[model samples]
Target: MDHYEQQALRELQQWQIRMNKKPSLFNGLTKGLQNKVNNVIPDKIHEIMTSAIKNIVRAALLGSEFTTKKEVPSGLSLAERERLVRERLRFYKKAAATEGAATGAGGLFLGLADFPLLLTLKMKFLFEVAAIYGFDIKDYRERLYILHLFQLAFSSDARRREVYQKVLNWEATILEFPSLQAIDWRRFQQEYRDYIDLVKLLQLVPVVGAFIGAYANYHLLDNLGDTAMNGYRLRFLQQITITPK
Candidate 1:
């Protein structure tokens, strides 16, 4: 392995240690708070939001309409590909911060609009990163991998460990994934909801909204970018033990 690949492998090993950890006391408290908040939200609104997120994610998983660029040449080195991936991430982080600031300043209605808009930004970034890593986003399996990356970035501690295991051993689990309709989307949505609850709630407030939105988005995108880089690094650099047919 070359120097850069060796550096990446070391980073991936450290990330694996983080992903395998159990939830801490702080995590337990946060989850409890999320449950209390959920209790206060009317069932109808909760259902509507969950259904919307699920359908949007399902559509993304099945379609490549978001990506205009084709996959890179197969001959590109891992170092070269990761350099391009980092560049894309820098560009998208600016975009996300911009979008977040604009919507955040517009009061309640526009604050709510950030949900789908930011989701689109994040997904589009993931598609670009996948293509940079030479994965075809047009393939459903690749798209599913993208979703796992998303879950890994944003889920609660318990859910993060579960999703991390699937991604870590993806050569086996990827094929075992159930049909799209079978995914527990309610849980998916809730875990994602709980993860971002604190920062996102502050994003709805009046005077502080814009600042919170910009900082939150800038950093969230930054986090996702790092997680995605290491995710693909782990997948490509690790040795896979293929089962016999």
Candidate 2:
């Protein structure tokens, strides 16, 4: 090991410690817990989702501002941003019909930014878009429960089966409404189970879901993976998976 390599390692460690010390980094969680989970999963998903969504939102906001504050940022020229967002919206919408609002990151942002009512509406809209692509989200009550499960399970760096059980624990509470209250459990449960499949898809898909899970855990826990560890893991996987002709 050379002096330069050792020095770089020390610097990276110190930087991580410094980041841990910052309260906003973990968004108020204790340093110990942050060390445990890390914001690896959610953070990555947020990064990609935000990058995709922000531009779309920026386009809409800019469009609205054109009549007032017409000036635009240097890199994000209004015309260019608009074009890119439109393209993204189209692609995502094509991926699944219930995904229409999910098509444009900007549109999702706008929905979230508007208010609680709008937030719920936007969620419903996302489900609708998914349905358009042949995904079922017709069970509102159960769909809500599934969403809660997703939020809780991916909300931290926990084991998959462990988190899944935790989600199931909420079933009683979610089903408390009597049949007389007009909430139908049989139908809703079926649909909710289907939505669970969607959530799992986002968590387990090799590149997309795994990266999201890693990013979410990293950001949530305020810790970075050992780069050396990551490199070794990748090499190991490649060695095992690749075969000579």
Against the true structure, candidate 1 reaches a TM-score of: 0.91
Alpha-carbon lDDT of model 2: 0.33
Per-model lDDT: 0.80, 0.33
Winner by lDDT: 1
Q: How far does residue 237 in candidate 1 sit from its true spot (Å)?
A: 0.9
Model 1, position 160: C-alpha lDDT score: 92
As for candidate 1, its clashing pairs are: none
Could you tell me how far off, in angstroms, the CA of residue 42 lies in candidate 1 after the best superposition? Answer: 6.1
List the candidate 2 regions with Cα displacement exceeding 4 Å: 1-126, 129-138, 158-163, 166-245
Clash count per candidate: 0, 33
| Residue 47 Cα positional deviation in candidate 1, in Å, after optimal superposition | 5.2
